[model samples]
Target chain A: MSEPIVVIRGVEKWFGGLRALGPVDVDLKPGERLGLIGPNGSGKTTLINCLSGLFVPDKGTIVYDGRDITREPAFRRARMGIARSFQIPRPFTGMTVLENLLVPMDYLGSHERSELERADEVLASVGLAARRDAPAESLSQLELRKLELARALVTEPKVLVADEAMAGLSENEIDDVLALLMRLNDTGVAIIMIEHIMHAVMRFSQRMICLETGRIIAMGTPQDVAQDRQVQKVYFGERAGA
Target chain B: MRTLPFLVIAALILVGGLFLPQFVGNPYYFFAGYVVLQYVVIATGWNILGGYAGYINFGTSAFFGAGVYVAAFLIKAFGAPLPVQILAAGVVGMLLGVATGYLTLRIQGVYFSIATVALVVVLETLIHNIDYLGGASGMQTIAPPAPAWFGGQTQYVFCAMLVLAVVAVVAARFIERSWIGRSLRAIKASEPAAEACGVPTLSMKLVACAISGAIIAIAGAPYAYYASHVDPLSAFSLTIGLNALAMPLIGGTRSWIGPVIGALLLASVQQIATVTISSEFNILAVGIVLIAFVVLAPEGILGLIADLKEKLRRRGARP
Candidate 1:
């Protein structure tokens, strides 16, 4: 509606002459849910990396909150309210679950309440309050994902880009993560969901966009995109045929 | 199993030092004791980058040698006070640490460690070939006001202990509670994930290196003056780099007490063995002990204690 919270214009990225992703344009408004579904090597993760400042696109610019962040370092971008959780949870193995949250909370010094309280609350938000004292190594698959989310949440981010928060999980586990994303989105935080879990992304996303060969081939309501001939031929044809 | 045993050993050293006068009415034991305490600072400093962040820095000699030189040059040239000289160690160490961190932190683990080793060599050559401040022949580092004011060896011991006390307390507090410590732990576990979380991994690595270097340099300042000698061979010696790491591993780099114990035990052995063995054997003994410890106890003495404690706990003794 208003100025998009994130604007990616004509973004082109390449890895050693392999034109991985490209000259694409997308805008995400505040609190909007974006479901980015793409076939393997379709550059979904590559695009997310560009948006999160992991890799600078060779061409085009990234504008966030009325500022061009093309040259800002990843940490500076994070401090400026951008947070992303890895596909595989990386919970600083030596620290407790509570300590993982504390790392990002340090930037909130004098800007909020005590770090310990904020850390505990974030742990609670991710349903990890019970495991607050547990070493990150001891956490199970679901718990590690929760810890990852808690770590990002503690940054009090405007955008939370989760790269495959639910992968290789059972149906029940998928529901658990979907519910968590829903709760995060409900809190007025924009979420960029990059997932291969089709049904989960379709059900959870307010809108869905599908990619094929690093190009956005289909973008519409979940049903419309799913029924679209291009998506069906590329995605469902492979999975269904397999 | 971690640093606890080292604390007990340091206590024993303190108690024995109090009773040492009955054996010799001189400052010899105090001087040796000062070296051990200073190593505690050095090893702890090295561990912030080496053990905590999982980045090995053999360039500790650079910081130690730098401090000794700075202190000597200041006191010799401008007659700067003792406090100012100590501050110089920290400032210069941190600055050098930043350079090392920036250049090497982005590389892999072994490369970073090799960079440090090479850094020591490059820095040593630069200083050894230089002309001012006594060159390779070295300068005599002057004693601070403590021994002169209180007028005895005991006061010097007191001063060394004071520095050790502050260093240990500050180190323990930071590594346990501070934000920098947590980020370091993250980097240690997984750098890619840490970067994804916006850790500024490179900067943090350098900051750790700098602080570690600064502390080691400051610790070496008084030690140089206590010995009243600062040769490039002694201060920037590769052996100093080796000894700095030995203690942290033996005592259990996981905790604050590990390096302290490692330093004290090895120092005590060296001190006692000096009476029976030659000076050349002292450094050789360090290498031997490190090798023996590495072979016999991969987890170090603290890890051994932890294994024993677990056994005792299972046997219901811990209750």
Candidate 2:
């Protein structure tokens, strides 16, 4: 189609000579549901971190919306409409769920409708209107994930990278999140779902990629990647070889 | 909304200062009262960074000491007016705050606190060794200005600043009620989440530091003039740091007015204890209160009021 919305070429990150992830390249298009699946320490998170500007890549350039954001700070990337959810949901403890949505809205600095109204609508859209005033620490795990998504969505981001949003979630909860993300995809927001859960990810993602030891071993349709020799060996090795 | 008692108490202290000779008639209490106000300023400032942002800074005395040395130098050399001296001190403190924010904000855990403590030691050693800014001998023979207005009177200056403090409290209260205040509270609660949601955590923290440093420094100028002189030891000493932390903890870090209340009440009690019991016991006494309150009343006296209100509400609803 047209140029990809996100292009990562020759990206590499190392922690003290340990290449946690890279020399990797990937492209994400507008309104695409991309599933990034990897075993533990497969560099999925690292790649996401580099893309979100959490850590500067040791090498390679990350182009988003036709500009190189390789050296941008996390906040600047957010301002440019790039957002991500943490692997561990970090709802601000002691703040209401509604307030969690409102904090990021302040970054917009007097844009669009009233700030409070904007926060309220975001909360409602996430199915957290009833729990808006509740302390974040008190939220159920699923609710926390929803609040996390609402926060990323509040920036009106073009790309929302959800890191392990389905981790530790029940099967039904996983389905719930899948549906929620699908709804957003329908609204033209590209979502990069980094997950370990196979069935849910397979059902949700239009395309799936498998990462092993910081390198992409497989990238194709769910069935293709799942049936790939290396992917099957890695999962089989974990069960019997380990 | 929770700051009413504090506003009233601060007013009462000012009124009490008016008729000091008729009541306790002790200059020592006035001295202590002045110290309390100064501590309120420090505690409030430290609370912005330490209490609100959860960045514990042990180098408050460094900024306070900067205000002390600069104010003393201006008065000693050029004979600057109190207002001018105070204004200069505030600007210096704000600048120092910016520098500290830049240097230490990136650090997490004990490293941040250590950086601040190290800053204090660095500044203190510089003052102790250097000949200018009073060195070891310290500035002496300072004459506390009576100010020309109100006919060279303490009452006039006191009234004006007391009015100013009231205005400051009001503005602080208004901020507490508004959007910026809520954002600070959010950032304080969880910085990463706040940032992800679009709160500018770094800038919010820097602004807190700037506002905090400026106010604490402004509070110092009057005290520097009141004491008539300041040495490196008295100005940069851990006493101000201890008092600052203590007042906020004792009053409860929950509300904006908490530190102010803690400063006045705790300062008054210590003054009376020093006179009636013994001078040496004063330090021991406040230290005890600091430890005891944090351990026993972690919520502070204000939190107690909230509990009492809840109990009363429950009782009224009983069948």
Candidate 3:
């Protein structure tokens, strides 16, 4: 795949001797759809944090676009074309939905006229044109999630890490987010989706990897990973039992 | 075209201020007017960082007091003119602000506030032990003779403060409509989210700190000349700190007009209370008003007005 967009080698993170995530390796190619699923406490969020420069991994390195960014600050990483949406939507309160998108666009040092145009385009793409002028605090749950996605997209990141973008959505809403991710991926941006919704992940991911206790236990095609004895015993078995 | 009306109004205010001494006849007018204008500067300055960036600064007196001391030192050593002193004070204030922000802003939220409070104590102590600056006592500063164009020393300082107030308000208004203001609001809403979205949060915060510090300190510079005395106690008074925070909150921190409205209203009331009741009663009044605004109008007068407008629009739509 034309020079992996992001390469993670021997990444490990620990919180006071309790290893949260680590000794993990991942490579994301351009336009790749990678689904990352793990049980709770499997360090899914921790890995994403490391990738996005929120927390420096205790060991190993993260190379993005052939550059080592293991120690870069989150803002610098974002400027280098890495963007992510929060599992819990964090719209900038006291601002209109369009203004929320404009924040990142402004940071890009774009012209004021173009920034406004870009903000409009992003809002329209997210199906939030009607609510463009509404205060972020006034948005419904679904709209807030869409606003989060729009804010991420405004930066035009090369890699988008969607951390549970469909966490609390209804069945149809889940499909809607899945389709949106697919469309976004089609734009030549690699996407790492960490989701608990199994069917959505299975249908969206070109390849699936399951993590457990800071370790990758299974990695393969949807059917191959699902039918594997270790994967079913550890991941699907726990879901079925619950 | 949009700015024409604002520029015209500003010019009228300046011209009217130039002739204010002609009619008032009372030296007391300039004296009281000077105090009101001083709060205008302080409140507007405080709002830039506290309101826009959501970083509550409990050490307003530190920057203000630094300016007072900087001016006092210059006067005592080199017999610096008022203009020179004001400039020096702004620089010192900006430096202290940047230093304090660099050290404390990393901690963020309430912890950052506590660090500011600590800064006040540290600065006050440092100034107290310095005998050249009068230590705990104070130094008397006889300002250079007022310019021939002004009638008296009080009038000169009053005009100086008027110029500063206008400049501070104009600067604040410009910032409110700029990208810097939007970034600050984003940081205020959610620092982590703002960072993830590519805002250099620390750098933006430091810029806010420097501007806020410089403007507030500029306000204190004239006080050194007006009062003709400078002491650690009054220079670093906690009342100034509290009032600085209270005025912006009471008015509305979002726009420059809020602090202007708040400082004028609050300072006028305090002036009246100080004369009719007692000087001590002024503090009590400020405390009461601050609490009332915090509880009843958290967004200050501006937020309340916005809410009322929304309600009226809803009513109109329903009918």
- Of 1 and 3, the candidate ranking higher by lDDT: 3
Model 2: DockQ against the native? 0.52
Q: Model 3: per-residue lDDT, tens digit, A64-85?
A: 9999999999999998999999
**Candidates sorted on TM-score, descending:** 3, 2, 1
Model 3 per-residue lDDT tens digits across residues B1-319: 2567877887889889988877777888899899999999999999999999989999999999999999888888998888998899889888988999999889979998999999999999999899999999998987778887788889989988998898888888888777888889999999888989999999999999999999999999988789999999998999999999999999998888899999999998998888889999989999999999999999999889889999999999995
- Can you give the TM-score per candidate against the true fold? 0.87, 0.91, 0.97
Model 2 misplaced stretches (Cα beyond 4 Å): A111-113, A236-242, B2-29, B148-164, B174-180, B304-319
Scored by Cα lDDT, where does model 3 land?
0.90
Best by DockQ: 3
Error of 1 at B250 (Å): 2.1
Which residue ranges in model 1 land beyond 4 Å of their true spot?
A110-115, A240-242, B1-24, B78-82, B139-158, B161-165, B195-200, B278-285, B288-319
Q: What is the DockQ of each candidate?
A: 0.52, 0.52, 0.78
Best by lDDT: 3
Each model's chain A TM-score: 0.95, 0.95, 0.96
